[model samples]
Target: MSRLIKNLFALIPAFTYRRSHLAPPVQEPLLANNAADSTVILGAGIIGLSTAYSLSEMSKQTIYIVDPASKACVGASGQCEGAIGDFGVENELSPLNQLSYELYQQLAEQQSGKETFGYSGMDVHALSSHGFNSSDPHLPWPVQEPEDISNLPAWLKVPRGWVAGLIANQTHCARLDPPKFCRFLQKECESRGVRFLFNTTALSAATDASRRTLTGIKVLNKGSKKAMNIPCKNIVISAGSWSEKVFSTLFPSSRLRIPSTEQQPAQDWIRLKIKKPRRSEAGTKGSCQQIWLSADSEDLDIHMSSFLDGEFYAAGGFVDLSDIPDTPDKVTSPSHVTDIIEQNTREFLALGLGETVQAVGSGRALLPRLTTNLPIMAKAAWDDLFPSKTKLQEHSSPIAARPVGDDSDVAGGVFVSTGHYLDGFALGPASGKVVSELITGQSPSVDLSNFGFPKADEESGDSRDN
Candidate 1:
């Protein structure tokens, strides 16, 4: 049934936008006054929409989401292969990843009958040259050896040089269609009175005279030659890789800067629709399995998964950051990146399993750090925003004491939630929930000490908080 729905959706024109299943048709033009008294959320991706939806559920305040795209999930969120797995088991972010997984399970339960976001349990296999072994302690999930290789699908032909494969506990991993999931979130937010300003670019944040408190944001309507200031009590920057650029423009002179976030060279993937062979012909059930492959000699890792419609997606390879232009066209895939991914795909699946190529694409994500690999999610530092001790002490009390208002409040407020890197989708829900807690002055559910901003004296050139 889900596959049928997906195929129906695939037939729609690529440029045609999906309407909100929950919100009423937007009847008013996006005016500054419409956002007055709203909690303005920047960026309409998964993080931004998730935060907005969480905020709307908790607060009666109007919610306004701004994005340059025509709809949500048009950026990295859309490009993601929705593998909701706790891939951080051996790292500092393991707890957070687990929390996100649980939250996703809860969300799936809540949206049970109304919509299908392509959620399903599946086994994830890790392939390597070392051969299958259950003794690997680094993998958090239980591992088991397959009974025989004869039962495996024909498309999963092991590479010539690889000898080992381990399957993760089937309960630990799940899959969803990211684009569809994001649209569901948008619909829920809209039903909760969230207003979306699509095709709107947030140029900068408007702060008070002291530059301590954010009053509103300056936004430009890309469709019309008009600009306006939308008064907001609290502003959350969830703009993914572009968060730092937006933050810098809003507070150009602040002593604390979001460390340079670099864009990873793009990764490309090809989607192919194939005809499933008969069980008699393939000698098996013909189930599509997800595969992860890595070898000691190869620095790159290959990830492959298949959809219900017999469409397989395979992605691999990396490009040098220096080779990409600052404002390169994002809609088009780079030839070099595509070529490398194609080569990797062919090497991984040597059987040529597909009947027709459906789509080819690439994604370049901006990571918060090139070093310690931790996401930044906290309030802007006082000293960095207000260097003068006298001014800091003078405005500190009032800024902290100001009460929340419908339109705008004087209390200083600037929050950042980015730098999740490759785990953005895996961690996005939890990140948004935590950021909302911070904005609302509620205690965060998780200990965020590791995710906080570095003190001025201890700051390094890198973005790592540790």
Candidate 2:
């Protein structure tokens, strides 16, 4: 029944945008005059939305999510693969990964995630061309579904040099429609009194006299070209790749900066439908099982395969250094970029499979990334933003002067949560929970001591980064 439900949900097609407005939509859920207890989140991507959703449960302060995009999740999170599993088990972020995976389970139970966001556990079949017996694995090993590569449908293929094996079983992993899950999160956030300010750009931030804390932000309505000040108690920047721009604009003279060498990393996506649907044990429609195979090691390019709503999903291909646009709506792929993904998808299904499929719903989405490949999930260091002029004379390090493990009231501060790259979808919930915990002055479920703001003084050139 679970498999049946998954296929059924996948059969329903994903939605596309239809811009009905000559201009973008108006901002909403604006706080009343003289309000100073609200938090303004600086992006509607998954991280910001998740933060808002989690924050709503912890506080009654009027929450406003501001985004330059007309709608939420138009960036990385909205277009994620939604394939989730226990990641970082052996790394520094293991606790964070495990905490997020558990939160996903808890949230699924609380929100009927299966129905709301199509969350369900599934075994991940890993395909590799390394050898007959797999070599050193890049992912953690957890098996629930027994290996049955021989029984795979004709539409699925095991390339000439590749052999298939179960890497993660149902107990450790799951998949969902990312777009659907994002919309579901947005609705949940809205229901909890979180107001969304779509088509609104956060121009800059105002700080108090001490230059230590935030006062509010100035946002411009794209449609009306009108700028307004929205007073807030705190600020959260989950602006993905745009975090640096927001930070620079907010604190023009601040020495602090988000790592920003990378730009406009995109994932080319395509969906294929089998000409003849296969059947399963109970005579229900069987979609193609998920398979991921890396074709390159240096470039790290992999072919992604999964089934959603009767369509085989493939999303893997990386583009580098495209111009990062001013807004999410303005982001686009280079011509024929998705054609490569579509071409690859058709070729993979036909390789030794002799099955024909229809490829559709092809597009590319710009992803958020950090050069350090780690998330900056901490509050802005008050000292870093305003370095003491006498610091060098006093021989004091600004980085050392900053506070550590601060869980105090942000009454006039800001929080930054971005640069998860491909793991953004899986990590969004935990990041949101942590930010909410920070705002509420509670101990974070995952320790963020290492994921602090980067400082030039650090030997690694990034202060406890990633």
Candidate 3:
């Protein structure tokens, strides 16, 4: 038999005892739309799924999600270490970051995530390597590991000169398999009547010129080029890295652009997913660990995490930006980047051999970012873009009038919620909750006044595509 088959046979004993049967994969082979559905969520990543989950729970309105990919979370969401904490906490995202922590706990209970998605507290560690230029991701966040390696997870095996240090992140986070968590959210959303349209592209917004409100979205099924106007009272652009393209495509005539003028370049990453060693009775399994692999001085390189669900995820590839693929589906790992990361991945897999855990899958993601590394949550100015996911009163533009629901005092329907750089998985829950509240006429749970797009007129003169 082949080596892969032999490895699988060796792992079956561990798998039988430690691995839980995941539910049948969620499917969306057929596309469907309803005119009466009041909301269209673009992108089916963590943010979009969370938005739909929150919307269904709060308003109980039919929510439709559109994505250009055949499957959800084909970007960063699919590749992250699932470290749900203050890893990349920015001042603007602080509230949502903490709130998402708490929300994860509650959702874990509600969804049995601890058992379902392998939720458990994660121990954060920073490691230094002699292999590259620099190792610390939390620049200025000092290294604290002494000569003692006892504090690290038993499954973690570092090289001779490498040292491991702990990060004092107080938030209670755990192992969250992105695919499993998203499926859980999607399952919940489906139960709440949310519809997902995969392999679909949102072309633009349908507006009421007299009222300055978004009445619908023009979406095209990529499989057949069959376009349909999904009538809705509101829209949320939780489109991740594709936010710029989504915004520009939806408003080719607008002066507004995502990231406005490109404050920072985006990086590319490759993800290595492998079967994890079963929990050890030796007691070192304390909390799953988020390992930051860095050298004495490279800009950025790698990060990894092992989970309770018998799965391991590690992502670290490059420090440069590239052209954003037309869609997340088109993203592929460059050969050079993969070469750099695979050495470490192979080492990690070797470390797990004592437990018989093996490789399962591998993938890539574009880490779209800005100088701030926070998501945009704003209302599109009436004249330019669709005010997709905003509260009417707080963000209405000068031309704003009554929205589709006729809230009477406010107008605008396009709300933007993207640019979540690296924290999309951690921040997704609270982002969804707040976006749900905003679109449903409730005050947002967290203040997003500082995020999102500038008014169309304010965004003129310097607008450049990301």
Candidate 4:
């Protein structure tokens, strides 16, 4: 059994090499002319694309995805490490995580012959300061002692008495090349008659005269200064950190509060290319090994993963969010990013790992984090007191109604699905599924009350219920 395990590990590099080169199937021509009667999806990140794909599969409406970036997943989605699993997730979110994993499995099965959105099952290890408990129910894998603590991989730095927990290899945990996955989703959505409008920004939403129902959106084409209206029956906002900004443009007066979504502090990431050693030095200290490490210490948390292509991805060190630029292109201090890379490398060196740095960079756009640490997925509401069918002249008039809350009777056509924060990729598919169901008036597959918008009392700074 041990010999078989070694042999299987040896074949990983070759398998990864082959998989990396496999091209995704060609995409069909985009149906760009279907904007008028389409469902406009603002933002082309994983959340938006996944929602588009789900909607296309269940409905025949034309899906129009609009984004300011040149392509999808250009923000936090692209910068992520692409690890998707339920480990360390809160209990409330586990169901969504599980659902997403199942959806990904279905997607992989559908594309049996193609590169699988960079999907691969992986073994994960968590280094904890506390002793390992083999009987922990939360741990899907068995706890095992490290094979060689003294001769551990040069890149792993753990305290002498720290315990290592090995997640069962058969667990649902997985990893993927995030950008590749995003591209695959885009292709899938396109093939299903979804239209994409890249390099275009959704300036604002247009609503009916009473401002009770969303009717369309005003978009600005970056390539051409031409502006146009995209009439849609429903509007779905999955713009991540920018969700508030997008929604506010439509209902500026509606105090539909979303807990503040702030950008997380910037961190540094480094990619190191391990050089192949000579045959004589094959099992030596410099030999490359696939390592997946998640270590939590008093001061910092580190996540590092090594790929089959002799590349190691490591991210660490947090700086104030104010230190980073709001846009990816405007990162003023490259040295700061480099400093973080060096700091992480030093930690790896402490573990005796020899790393030859190939690339050092920082994510220009900071990741958005929500205060509640739960995603916001719910419909917008009009003030209940307002006449449902006010004349066009009173469209611009304000109406007195109870604040936006779960119990409010106002019903609007806009749906919000954001605040997944760092778990966007892990929860993207499930979020899309639920949002699609809500749009179609179908029952949600899972209870989404926890992910729904904050109730009136919660939004008003009153937590008496809790």
Candidate 5:
């Protein structure tokens, strides 16, 4: 029944934008606005929406989620192909990932009933070599042998053991219709009294000097070009790639200037910028464009296999830098999408896969990266505070208040939750919950001290998650 509902939900439109002047269709529950302690959320992507929903439920705060796009999740999150798995990466072991996974399961339980969002499971299959020819030479067939399990890393190893037909299984991993899920989230938030401001662009945030906090935001109604100020007690900058821009506007002079040490004697100030660098090197430049493969029923349970016609086919892996702009926060170009499909087709044939599957979709995402590939998930340092505020303030520097060594107990209010890259969907929920816990001044539901990213000094070397 859930599978049938999932199939039916696939037919529903993910989102439909209503102009600023035009109100959404009258739905009683959707019209409720009990949020009083307003929280101005910057973006309407999955993370922002999820956070907004949770905040509304927990605090009943007047939550206002605004976005310039016609509807929520129209950005990177909207373009997703619905792959939700941790892949057991070291960075994914944090409490944020676990919470996100749990939250997704809960959301699935609600929507999987009558309002499917393609909430179905899948299996992660491994192949030793890039090529294998079986009955269908067009497809790269998996080598069926118990010994093959030895090739998989310990982290990816199955619970019982790997057999010829199946390798390992991630029971909770699922594939979702990204847009539909976004819409469902919006609906759920609205049901819980969160107000969504569509077609609204947050130009900038105004601060109250006396309070030493954000006062409100200036927003533009894209349709009428009218500007309005949305006042709120708190502002959560949930913008994805656009976060750096918002932070830059809020704190223009923010920079990480480190004096060069003995090895490299030079002093320079590196601007705090967010960018999505292409995953390509000189020689390996288009080597891993596309990927397509299949596992057996044992690898993916019957429930998950239903996502791929009760088989176990998955494809559409292509890497292209053409659409990625050097500047952050810009939408990936359609030309990049074209290249994705083209290169994906090439990889399909190379892997002996006959033709690209229509069920498969491709999208791109940008992940926050430190110099060493690990994420920077710490409170902004006191020295990095707003120039005007820090100049005359007598409070302790944000640097001094920074957590001693990756300990979760950092400064209050401010938090960091980026760096999922391609796995944000699999890990966004719990990350939001942690952020909520921090905001509410409660012990985090999960322990996050060990794997949490830390604040580093100039003398400290870059930290790698591997």
Candidate 6:
């Protein structure tokens, strides 16, 4: 089997367990002779399936979802360590993120009947020994007045804030069992007449005249590698992290010139220094056990859960990235990953947590790597030469087209609901509904002009074609 296929199937056991109670493989296709439907969704992740569910409920058109995976959510959505807090988007809490939180609330209530989509309230605590960097030239924020660090310890000189605690007390974020959530949406969509084609790979999207609109897709059966062509009126690209690949094929020129920007909000480049406890004290119940630091150095985002007086208390530090890198490869260096983890571990040591470090795990994020320590909701016009898209206001000129803009200018009917990043779990429902409105030519319940297509006049200054 191809390496890709092998990796996909290897995840089936884990995927099946999370979504449903299933026996071993049946050794048969889920849909042997089923035919394609009208509206085809190109992914089986939360975004794709959620989009399908919304379309199935709001329109008369049939919906079909195709994925190259052995089961649903096996990609980024299924395996993500689901944490649904709003701290990252606090600065840019657009209507999009707000709506997402609401949808998650509704799903929580509905799923209560079956205890499906295991949902829980997440408490967030944004801690920092030192505040954000004001003079750092790379930061997007304007420098404020200088302040004194003389009274404070050198390490704790950075200002600290409880951003997460405030959000939890005020906004109420929900944590989801991602696998369960994906399955719930899948079953719900299927019940509404949306068909799923697991293990079915879509190789390419074929467009009609004008070369701007998509007409159909060329796909293959994963097990047999047999190819087929399925036509459709619309296609929603929900392939996460890998989305650029699809978009590149759709707009080769844009791919070469414009480039899909990296969405990781932080560079993951903080340094970590850990001091191991003495082995002689290992057998003691409570020897000289205490984590201490200069009180200036702390990672605000990484939390440490510890046992204290029969209760659990969490603490950590925060250090924001200066800007969201435009290329994943640029920010995903080994040192970058090591720095983030090390910094996080350093904070744990400072807290005097457990003696021996238990474990560590990390992965790429979907959210734009942030520097302002807040969510971004602005939109800007497409400019290939600019190297980056700006998050401007709703009335900003050159309104940003949806990420699915590759064929949107041609399809004229296409729209997208993405960039939720870490907010995907909270915002998927609302985003799905809004996208449905755009797809059906109806006004969205929310004001989405910030994400709307730009007018001809707005494009006048654009000497670029992307």
Name the top lDDT candidate: 2
Measured by TM-score, the strongest candidate is 2
lDDT of 5 by residue, 1-466 (tens): 1111111111101221211212342322223232225677766776677777667767755777776655666545554445554334343244455566667777778656224675655443433232343452222223333335453322122334323233234463455656566677778887877777766676776665433455566778778798877666556655554554555665566553211121201000000111222222201121111112333322221111222211112223222232223222243334443344344233322221232223233223443322333332334443454554555544645533443233243223234444433444555566567656655556777665632333364224443221
How does model 2 score by TM-score? 0.80
Is 2 or 4 the stronger prediction by lDDT?
A: 2
Total residue pair clashes for candidate 5: 12
Clash count, candidate 2: 3
Question: lDDT-based ranking, best first?
Answer: 2, 3, 1, 4, 5, 6
Instruction: Give residue 325's lDDT in candidate 6 (0 to 100).
Output: 35
lDDT of each: 0.58, 0.63, 0.61, 0.57, 0.44, 0.42
- Residue pairs in steric clash, candidate 4? 141-168, 154-352, 154-353
The TM-score-based order of candidates, best leading, equals 2, 3, 1, 4, 5, 6
Q: For candidate 5, which ten residues in a row score worst on lDDT?
A: 264-273
lDDT by residue for model 4 (1-466), tens: 1111110110000011112222323323444444335688887777898899998988888788877655566665655556665454445777787788788777867875125565655555555555556554223234555544544444466666666655434254556666577778887887887878766777776655443555677888778887888777678888776676677765566656566534443444555544433123211233333233334442334446644333555555444453333223233235566566556554554322343454533343334445675678776654421233343334445542423332233233678888665467777888899998887778888888877777655543311111
Candidate 2 residue-wise lDDT, 336-439, digit = tens: 76566666666666432454666655545665655555678987755555455324423644334445333243355778887666567777788899988987
- The local lDDT score (0 to 100) that residue 319 gets in candidate 1 is 38
Superposed Cα deviation of residue 306, candidate 5 (Å)? 7.3
RMSD of 3: 8.5
| Clash statistics: count for each candidate | 4, 3, 16, 3, 12, 27
Off by more than 4 A, model 4: 1-36, 127-163, 167-170, 210-212, 262-266, 275-301, 317-334, 346-355, 360-365, 384-412, 459-466
Q: Tell me the spans in candidate 5 whose CA falls farther than 4 Å from its real position.
A: 1-36, 85-87, 110-115, 127-167, 170-172, 255-363, 366-383, 394-416, 447-466
Residue-level lDDT tens digits of model 3 in 336-455: 665666566556443445444344544455555534334577766654443343335335554343453343443437778876655667778888888888887788988887676654
What is candidate 3's local distance difference test score? 0.61
lDDT of 5 at 391: 55
**Between the candidate structures 1 and 4, which one is better when assessed by lDDT?**
1
Task: Evaluate residue 111 in candidate 3 and report its C-alpha lDDT on the 0 to 100 scale.
Answer: 73
